[model samples]
Target chain A: MALVEIKNVRKSFGALEVLKDVSLTVEEGEIVTIIGRSGSGKSTLLRCINGLEDIQDGEIRVEGQQVHGQMKKLRELRQKVGIVFQAFNLFPHLTVERNITLAPIRTGRVSKADARALAEKVLAQVGLSEKIDAYPEQLSGGQQQRVAIARCLAMSPDLMLFDEVTSALDPELVGEVLKVMEDMASRGMTMILVTHEMAFARDVATKIVFMHQGRVWEEGPPSELFSSPKTPELKSFIGSNH
Target chain B: MQNLNFQQVLRYQDEFLHGIVNTLEMTAIAAFFGLLIGVVGAVLVGSGPKPVRILVKAYIELIRNTPPLIQLFVIFFIFPSAGIRLAPFPAACVALSIYFGAYAIEIIRSGLASIPKSQVEAGECLGLTRFEVFRYVVLAPALRNIYPSITSQLILLLLGTSVASQIAAEELFHTATFVESRTFRSFEVYALISAIYVALVVASRVIFAIVGAVAFRWPVRR
Candidate 1:
């Protein structure tokens, strides 16, 4: 079974329909890159997968378990899926260590010592093992984003979602965040990301999905999709990225 | 002004001290309850279900719209007639708490609102339940951000305690009236109590500053 699957998803913000009949699937260890223009419903779909946003119509399943409206079930699914945002929404009032351990410890998933150990582990993974005591505001944007990723990794999530994680970083800082994500992708983590970094997506994505007008316009292995575009929108989108 | 006589006012020194103590006690207790009500009411109004939220909104509106004096009258006079026999002191405390709680609700709601939406979303994405998110991430920063406003409200409530004298609570102002009636030292007694109220306000502000500093020693920036 696919690690992440969406079936006939429909979402709208009152009168404006953002996602109209969206569907996709990701097998375990698949790195799916979703590339689209700003309003292509890429981030909304990511939010729905984690049950952050309620769907008007459709089904989302993670690891073959249906994700829906039940609070407990959504939480259970959330434990397996982690999402990092473009804003790097670290709890500014908390230390890097507290930010990472809060969820695991507060939810009683692990003891404080274990959570501390997990924080250390993930921080090391993100190359920020020494910055555990720093506050979010004190860190550079790339470091904060990396902490957010480390914060998510502390939960030991089976799947990770990155919603334009590097979009908010400075051009100089983008490389560091992308490097962290590239490392995660190399480690066989099943991941879906919405990114404008075409080069990084070209190199790391096992599957590249081109979204246009709130639907998947073209999707396949990155090799086939990039070398032989099937849709004019995909061709133009790819052209514009260069 | 006529010649001032400190000696006459000093004769009621014990009474003045007693009143000042009473005033401090009433303000402390009422402020505690008022802060509690404000925090709880703010949380409920911000996140409670539609019906309860509406009820909270109504209560805040009702309390805020009417005069504090009227609210005191209802609590002190009407409630007893309705068989809820509260003593003058307790009634004064309750009245001030509910009255100030309305303003507190508004103050704290704006404080809570000042918290970025990203903070709440981060907490939610971390799988925290609704209440837990509010308690840890949202409430801490919200309270911190609004501490200055809340402190001002608290001091204002403390000053507003002068109105409790109408119910014969015998706090500082009431004692001043009693002393003035006995000694005919109207200006002196009133002036003394006014100075004492100022001191109390200053003292309470220092206390709140200490609390704001200590309680929020943790790292929370807006």
Candidate 2:
């Protein structure tokens, strides 16, 4: 079975249906890149996987635990899932190291010293070891985003979700963040990212899911989808990017 | 200004000093507990069960709607009718704490609301429990945003402590009244009291500012 499973999920905001009949699966060690235009529900789908957003119909499961309703069940599932947002969302009051270590420590699964060690390791992974003591405000947008990723990584999550993580960075800073993500993929982390960087998707994704009109319209190996253009929407999306 | 004899005022310094102490004590107690109420109300009422949330909302509205002086009167004078007698000082603190907390609840709760929902999402994604999210992620940034507002309300809370003197709590303002009756120098006494009040207000701001620096640990601007 796949690590994550969503079966015929539906979500709506008042009268507006945001996600309709959305179903997908993610296997272990697969780097799946979800690509789409703005408001294509790419970000919403990623949030659903982490139980950040509710699904009105069908079910979402991570490691076979239901991801809908019930707060305790959601928190239990949340431990295995790490999500990085475009906003960075670093706790403004905490130092960078504390931001990274806090969840790990609160879980009581790791000691304070161990959490510190884990923070150092992840910070180094993102090439941000020097910023251990600095607060989020002190860093550039890219740097702060990197700290956010390290904060997620410190939890040792089984699956990681990225919601348009590089969309908020300046063009000059986008490469560094994409590079870190590419490195994570190479290290065999199971990552599903909703991103706009088609080039990066092509380079790093094991599979690319093209979403159009609230559904996974086209999905395949990066080479196949990027080259063959399975649907008119994918073709135009790919065409527009170049 | 003819009766503004500096010598007479100096003679009543001991009484004035004692009143100043009472005012400071009651105000400090009120401010401290008011802040506590604000924090607890903000966190609990935001995430609480429906009935609990409604109860909190009612309290917030009730205190906010009524004048604080009447609230103080109720505690000091009215409650005794039902046999729940409170000393004047404690009664004053209780009234001001509830009254100040009403405005504080609104301020801090809005500050909590202003925290980007994504930050709370990040906490949950990282698997911190709800309480952990409130304590670490939600509260500090929320309070940091409203620190200035809190200082302003605190100075007001201190001035309101003078109202406690009507119940014979003998706070700074009350002591001024005592000295005024003795010297018949009403303007002189009040002017001196105002200076002292200003000094106290300035000191409170500095203290809370230092606290903001330490607790927020973020730069002045978010």
Winning candidate number (DockQ): 2
lDDT of 2 by residue, A1-242 (tens): 89999899999988888899998999999999999898889889999897888888989988988888689888877888888989899987788999999988998768986877888999999999999999888899999999989988888889989988888899999989998998899889999999888888888899999999888899999999999987999999999999
Error of model 1, residue B209, in angstroms: 2.5
For residues A75-126, what per-residue lDDT tens digits would candidate 1 score against the true structure? 7778778999999999877899999999999878889878778889899999
Each prediction's TM-score versus the true structure: 0.96, 0.94
Which residue segments of model 2 deviate by more than 4 Å? B49-54, B220-222
Writing each residue's lDDT as its tens digit, candidate 1 over B106-159 gives 999999999888888888888888788888788877888888998898888888
State the lDDT at A226 in candidate 2.
91
Candidate 1 CAPRI classification by DockQ:
medium
lDDT of 2 by residue, B148-202 (tens): 8878988889998988888888799889888888988888888999999999988
TM accuracy, model 1: 0.96
lDDT, each prediction: 0.89, 0.88
Model 1 achieves a DockQ score of: 0.58
